[model samples]
Target: MHSDRGGQYCGNVYRQLLHDHQTVRSQSRRGDCYDNAQAESLWSRLKTEVLEVRERPVFADLADAQRSVADYFDYYNHERRHSRIDYQTMYHSHQQLTTLSTLNCPA
Candidate 1:
């Protein structure tokens, strides 16, 4: 997983957790926005296309807002077309990963 050099990410506990999962942690260099541009872009799109368009929300209503945004993310991953991913949904990309799992096997 990729993360900034935040305190939470730099903690020994966090590093151990990732090590347990055999994850190769990639940390962005300090003051390098370009290192995390893709994440920044995604958040920007979500905020502009979803959050900014919504009416002012109450703190008590935060859960509902988060849920709505989560749903939109699902739709974007599974339905929306993107030239970068060759117009395939993220869901489709995941399916491609397990295509070999569907190979002929005895019942």
Candidate 2:
């Protein structure tokens, strides 16, 4: 389900795209910003932790910045620990998924 309060979601083009995919679109009530807190919080953390102190980039520099951000994301997923996620990196979460699957499989 795609969740957003953007006006583009209400347009015929977007609705048509969803219909083609047989997807359901869920929208929060208008003027309600807190409904998308998870997404907004992520953006806030990304900006404050990764982008806010960085030097502004020119058009050509954008590619380099994007590459750096991608690299950071890899490190973030594999190295950084999160308190809310039991102090484990996102990589640990994937390991848990596979471990459970292996243990549950029939011999």
* lDDT per residue as tens, model 2, 26-90: 98878887888866766676677777767665224768778867876787789878787799988
Question: Which lDDT tens digits does candidate 1 get at residues 16-49?
Answer: 9999999999999999879988787778878887
Question: TM-score for all predictions?
Answer: 0.59, 0.61
**The best candidate in terms of lDDT:** 1
Each candidate's lDDT (Cα)? 0.82, 0.79
Alpha carbon lDDT at 93, candidate 2: 80
| Candidate 2 Cα outliers beyond 4 Å, as residue runs | 1-3, 13-39, 58-60, 105-107
Best by TM-score: 2
